[model samples]
Target: MTDTDNRRLLRQLFDAALAVAQPSQCLHHFLPPPVKGRTIVIGAGKASAAMAAALEAHWPDEDLSGLVVTRYGYAVPCKHIEIIEAAHPVPDEAGLVAAQRILSLVQGLTADDQVIMLISGGGSALLPLPADGVTLADKQAISHALLKSGATIKDINTVRRHLSAIKGGRLAAACYPAKVVNLLISDVPGDDPAAIASGPSLGDATTCKDALAIIDHFSIAVPPAAREGLASGRYESVKPDDKRLQNVTTHLVATPQRSLEAAANAARAHGVTPLILGDSIEGEAREVGKVMAGIARQVVTFQQPLPTPCVLLSGGETTVTVRGKGNGGRNVELLLAMAIDLAALPGVSALAADTDGVDGQSEIAGAIVTPDTLFRASRLGINALDYLSNNDGHGFFQALGDSVITGPTLTNVNDFRAILIR
Candidate 1:
């Protein structure tokens, strides 16, 4: 296929992956029957606002009132449910206040009432109400440290769950006798419900000790109050067997594996065989990219996994250990690393993107790489290596006009990566 055709096909595959995870398409199937008394809605994540809107569209017109917090610019309109915009991947004052309101909203609920929670990726950072003794500033500092520490999403969430008031099943617990139904869109490796958005409305098997151990493993300096709370086990997350969560029900409405399958189906429609290399792969973004480059080379040189005219698809959240002063996200960093290792190999091109359409700090989802990637870079005086070293994949791709900017797809199923080999 020509370069234009390749790019179009790759984008189509990515869009197919995103389509399956959209709340409007997938949420109604899993929603519960109308409750006896009141049906309160609550949520936090990049996609929570959209999920709320979808729920409202499907639910019978009744007393459906609640709130959901989403990343800034990700909010969608909902007639009955309120949507609050907040920071993501790191909590801010808006999120803290919203979280507090949610906690208060669930109080004094009876067993007849039901709380519907639209959980998704970035929920952990979207609700940053610190535990009794911990402060929001401490949570923010620790979040910054974890983002740069290269910790897996699971580990980072383990720490956050213990330090927060609403995460790790605490939110559901707050609803006490009320039935809590959580619909989750998995964005972490393995789709472990407990780690998705720190499992705000689901039960957690992890403890304060686990959170402290993760902190020690990363050498993350915790604020004095936070440290004391962890050491004293005063901030332990609600366990799986907690009685308060007995009426809580968890559902995986969308996941990385499902999205990958959708992309694979799309590839088949394009007459390209798709080889999915597992949807739960995780590691440093750059290292994962290098490994993918080897796989693409294998497909080109030897017919091991699959033959030519095939696409290798994978989905999972990858971490970026930011050591350089450059603007880069996990998806772009992975693509840049692949570009460097592939060295503009003929008949090989690739696309990597965060399913939520925001890969890192920037709005760019990711970038597409072609056989002439390095050639074009050289012509433009763009040093790929220097940019990679500074973690500036966004800068490098923007210069090449290859950055995938799809501003807030309003849903997330982690990362979508496709390496097209002809």
Candidate 2:
């Protein structure tokens, strides 16, 4: 097929996957039976606000009240539920205020009340209520360090849970005798309920020891308050089977695997063989890109896994080691590395994007790279290798006009990648 046709088909696959994970589409599946008690809604994430809007639409006449925090620009209009915009991947004053409000809202709940939490990716940072002795600045410092340190989402969240007052089941615990129902849109690699949104409404299987280990593993610099909090043991989060959590129920409404399957189905409809490489792939971004490049080469050169005209689709979160202070997201980094490695290989094209429509802190979702990506860069006096080495994939792709900017999808299922070999 022509390049235009291929691009259209690929976009269709992406849209189909995103459509399945839309808040309006997935919210109904996780809504519990009409509870006789008051419904207090609370949440944090890129999708939380949209989820709240969906809840408001579905339960128009229900006695619903609460708050949800989403990344700035991801907020949707809601009637009763308050939509608070906050910083993401790093906490800010807005997140602190919103988080405090959520904690206060659930403080006086009784057994007769029901709390609905809309948790999704990015919640860890959006619901930032640092534990006692740990200031918001302290959390922000650690969060910034963790983001730049190339820590896995699991590890980053492990530290975040231990550092926060509302995360790691603490939010649900605050609801005490109230029934807490957590509706989750998982973006973690393994789709572990506890890692999504820092498992604010679910049990935290990770410990302070794990948090400390991650800090040391990434060589992250911690503030005095963070160090004390991690050592104090007083900041420990709630665990599963804790008597206080018996009334809390967590549900995974959507996941990366489901989104990947939707994309695969779209590919098949376009007469392209879709080879799923699993949805939980992880590891360093550039390394993962190299490995995927090898797979694409095999598909094209020897047809080991599949023949020509096949698309390899995968979804999951990947880490990035920040070696340079350049504008880059994991998806863009992966695409850049893949482009350099492919080096103008014939008939190979790929797209890497965060399903949430924001890759890292950049405005662009991700990027699209053709086999000639490196060649085009070279022709424009742009050194692809240098860009990758500097962790400036956004700069490189922006120069090429290949960055995929979708504003805010307002849903998170982690990263989505497709490599098409023709």
Candidate 3:
């Protein structure tokens, strides 16, 4: 296939991955039945606003009134459910206030009512209601430290669940006997309901001890008040057996695996054999890139995995330690490292991006890599190795005019990666 053909196919695969996670596709089947008293919708995440819009669109036109907070550019208009904009991947004053209101909205609910929580990636950070002793500043500091330390999502959320006033089943606890229904869009490695957005509605199996242990493991500098809260068990999560969370029912409306399947189908449509490596692949971004490059070489040189005209698809969250000062997200970072390892291997091109359309903190989604990626970089007076060392994947791709910019897709399913060999 020509480079244009290859890039088009890669783009199709990405669009397919995104389509499966959109609210219109995956959310309709999971909408809960209407309740007697009222159907209160409260949520926080990149997709919560769109989830609300989906729910309202399919409802029976009954009493459906609530609030949901999403990333600043992710909010879509909703008729009954109010959509509020907040910061994501990091909490801000807007998110804090939105969380406070979410808590207040769920209060004084009855057993006859129902509270539906639209949870997805970034929810934990969006709903930053700090615990009794911990301030939002403390939580924000810890969040920054964990993100830069290359801590896994599980560990980051473990700490977040304990420190927050409304995470790790605390949100469900607040709506006791009100039948909390969590409609989650999974972006985590394993589609663990309790791990999605720190499982604001689902019961938690982890404890404050686990949170403290993760802090120590990551060498995170926990604020004094937050540390005190953990030590005193004041910020402990609601246990799985807790009666307050008994009435909560969680459902994964969409997941990384589903998104990967969509991409695979797209690949097959283009007469390309699709190999889904896994949906839960996780590790450091650059390391994963190198490993993926090795697999692509195996396919290109030996055809052990499959013959040519094949695409390798995988989805999961990868972390960047952020040692460099340049702008780069995990997706682009992974691609840069992979390109360096491949060293202009013929007929091997790949695209890696976050399905939510925002990789890391930047508006750029991800980037594409070709067999001549390094060659093209050199032509542009760019050194791929130095870019990788400086964590400048976005810069490198932007300079090459190969960065994939999708803006806000109004949904979240973590990262999507595809390596095409032809």
Candidate 4:
């Protein structure tokens, strides 16, 4: 097949993967039956607004009412549930206000009242409510450090749960006797419910000591309030087996593995043999790219893994250490590293994109790279190695006109990567 055909196939596979995670498809299965009393909805994530819309469509006469927070530009109009747009991967005043409101909404509910909490990947940042002693600025500083520290989401959330009033099962505790059902879209690698959205509605197995250890491991600078909170034991979060969560139920509606399988099915439909590398792969983004490049090379040079006209598919979140101040996300960084490693290898092309559309802080979803990416960049006076070293994958790909832009997909299942060897 031509390079264009291969690229088209890759895009098709990506779309297939995204479709499997859409709110309309995944939310219905997790929805609970209508309750006798009022049903209060509360949630925070990039997908929360879409999830709210899905709930409204699924149960138009269920008498549902409440609020959900999502990233700016991800809000969908819902008649009953109020949708609030807030900053993602970082907390803003808007998010703080909305979180406070949500906390208040769930309070004072009786055992008859039911709370349906929609949680997903971006919820940790979207539902920012600092502990009593800590200020929002402190949370902001800690959040910035964690993002740049290259720490895994699990470690980052370990600290987050201790610092926030709403996370770590405090949200569920607020609804004391009320029954809480958490409908979650798993974006974390292990699909830990406690880690997804910091487990606001589930019991937190992590402790203050775990949070302190993570802070020490990353050498993250903590504000005086946060430091004291971690050391004083006064900020302990709700623990597992806590009776507060007895009435709470958690459900996993969508996940990365399912999305990857959808992509594999699409590849097979396109007459390309699809090999799934696993959906939960993790580690440094550039390193993972190099490893994937090696696999593609083996397929091309030896044809041992599979013959020509084959596509390798993988899904997972990869981290970047962020040494340089550049416009790029993990997917772009991975694609740049892969392009450099492949160099001039013939008949190999690849695409790496964040399934949510926004990759890091950039507007582009990710990028597409061919074996000639380096040669083409060189012709344009762009040095691929220099850009990669500077963490400027967005700049490099943008110059080559290979960046894929799909603004705010609203639903996320982490990263999607595909390599086509023909």
Candidate 5:
């Protein structure tokens, strides 16, 4: 197959992966029965708006009224449930206000009433209600530092849950006496409910002490009030057996593994054997790229894993430690690192991208890696090593016109990667 054909196949596999995670496709089945009292819908995430729209479309007869906040440009039309656009990966005034509104909406509910929470990735940042004595600015600073520190999502959320007023089961706690059901789209490595969206509607197993240890380990600069809260253990999240979560039911509506399976099925349809590496793989992005490149080489050199015509697929989140000033995103970094390690090896091509349609601070989802990727870069006077060192994967792929732009997929199941060997 030509390079064009390989790129097209890579994109087709990615599209197949995305199809299963869409709120419209995966949410309706998890909907609960309507209660006698009012049903308040509340959520925060990149996919929450789309999830809310799906709920409204399916349950037209039910009296549904509530609010959901999604990242800007991800909102869909919904008549009853109000959709609010907010900032993501960073907390802003709009997000703070929306979170406050959501917290307020769940109040005053009785046993007959029910609260349905649509949770997914990016919700932790989109729903930023700092705990008492901790300001939003403090949370913002800590969040920025954590992103740059290359800390795992689980670690970042451990701090977020401890510092937030609404996360880590506090949202469910506020809706006491109400039957709370959470439909979560898992973007974390293990699909742990306590980690997805910081477990706003689920109980937390992590503690404030754990949050402090992570902060110290990463050497994150914490605001004074935040540091005190963490050190004093004064801002603990709701524990697993918290009484308020007794009536709450958390369901995994969509997950990275299911999406990977979808991509595997797509490969099968094309007569290419698919091997799912793992859905929970997590580590530094470039190192993961190097390791995956070795596997791809192994497939070609010995065919130990599978035959020539096979696709190695994996799903999970990867991290990047930013040491340069250039634009950096985890998916692109991984792809660039992979391309460099492969060094234009024959009969192998790959694509790495975040499923949410945003790779990092950029609008591009990710990029494609071909055998001639480095060759094309050199022809254009671009040095792959220099770009990688500068943490500018976005710029590197943008120059090649290879960055996959899928504006706001309105859903996220973490990163999707496929290495096709033929």
Candidate 6:
């Protein structure tokens, strides 16, 4: 295929991956029956608003009233549910308020009521209600450290669950007497309910001790009060057997694997064989990219894994240990590192992006790499290694006009990476 053809196909694959994860596509089959008393919809994430709108469509005649917090640009208009715009990947005042408001709405609910929690990725930061003795600023510091420490989503969330009032099944506990139906969109590796938004509407299997271990392992500095809460178990999350959480039920409406399968099917339609490397791959960003590059190189040089005219697809969250002074969206960093390792190997082209259409704090989804990547950069006096060293993959890709932009996809399934070999 020509360069233009390769780029177009890669984008089509990416789009297909995103399309299947939209609430409109994956949420229909998981809707819960209306409660006898009332339907209270509460959520937090990049997809919360869209998921809310989806619920409204399915239950247009039902009396649905609640609140959802989402990334600022991700809000969609909902008839009964109030949508609140908030910051993500970092806690803000807006998120704190929304979290408190959500908690208040679920209180004093009767057994006849049901809480429909539309949870998705990014909810941890978007619903940052600090626990007693912990300030919002304290949680923000911990979040900042964990994000840059290259900690796994599980570890980061373990700490967040202990420090927050609304995470780690606490939200479900507060809704006692009222049954909880957790409609989740999985973004974490392995689709662990407790890791998806820290299982705000489900039981948490992790303990405060786990949170303490993560903090120490990551060398994350915590405020004294926050430290004491974890050390003393004063901020423990609701456990799986917590009596208050006995009535909670969960449904995983969408996930990374399903999205990857959708993209793979799209590749087949294009006459290209697709191999899914994994759906729960995890590690430091650049290292994982190098490993992926090695696999792609093997396909090109020895055709070991597969012959030409095939694509490799995978999905999961990759951590970026940001030690550089540039925008280091894990997706872009992976693409940049892969490009460097490939050394513009012939017959290889790839695309990497976050399905949510935002990487790190940048609006850019991710970027693309091709066989001529090195040559193109050299011609433009852009040193790929220099940019990678400074963790400026977003800058490098933007300068080459190769960064992918898809304003807000309104859904999140972590990172999507595809490599096409020809």
Steric overlap count per candidate: 0, 0, 0, 0, 0, 0
RMSD of every candidate to native, in Å, equals 1.0, 1.1, 1.0, 1.2, 0.8, 1.0
Local accuracy by lDDT, each model: 0.92, 0.88, 0.90, 0.88, 0.92, 0.92
Flag regions of model 4 displaced more than 4 Å.
60-62
For model 5, the stretches where C-alpha displacement exceeds 4 angstroms are 60-62
Total clashes in model 4, counting residue pairs 3 or more apart in sequence or in different chains: 0
Off by over 4 Å in 2: none
Error of 6 at 92 (Å): 0.7
Evaluate model 1: give its lDDT: 0.92
Please give, for residues 1-422, the per-residue lDDT of candidate 5 as tens digits: 88898899999999998999999999999999899999999998999999999998888485989999999999999999999988878899899999999999988999999999999899999999999988888888889999999999999999999999999889999999999999999999999988999989888888888999999999988878888987888898888898888899879999999999999999999889999999988999999999999999999999968888999999898899999987679999999999999999999999999999999899899999899889999999999999999999999999999999999998999999999999
Please identify which of the two predictions, 1 or 5, would achieve the higher lDDT against the true structure: 5
TM-score of each: 0.98, 0.98, 0.98, 0.98, 0.99, 0.98
lDDT of 4 by residue, 217-237 (tens): 889998777888888887899
lDDT against true structure, model 2: 0.88
> TM-score of model 5 relative to the true fold?
0.99
**How good is model 6 by TM-score?**
0.98
Show the colliding residue pairs in model 1.
Answer: none
Per-residue C-alpha lDDT of model 2 across residues 67-121, encoded as one tens digit per residue: 9999999999998999999998778999999999999999887898899999999
Q: What are the clashing pairs of model 4?
A: none
Considering summed lDDT, which 10 consecutive residues are worst modelled in model 3?
319-328
lDDT of 4: 0.88
Off by over 4 Å in 3: none
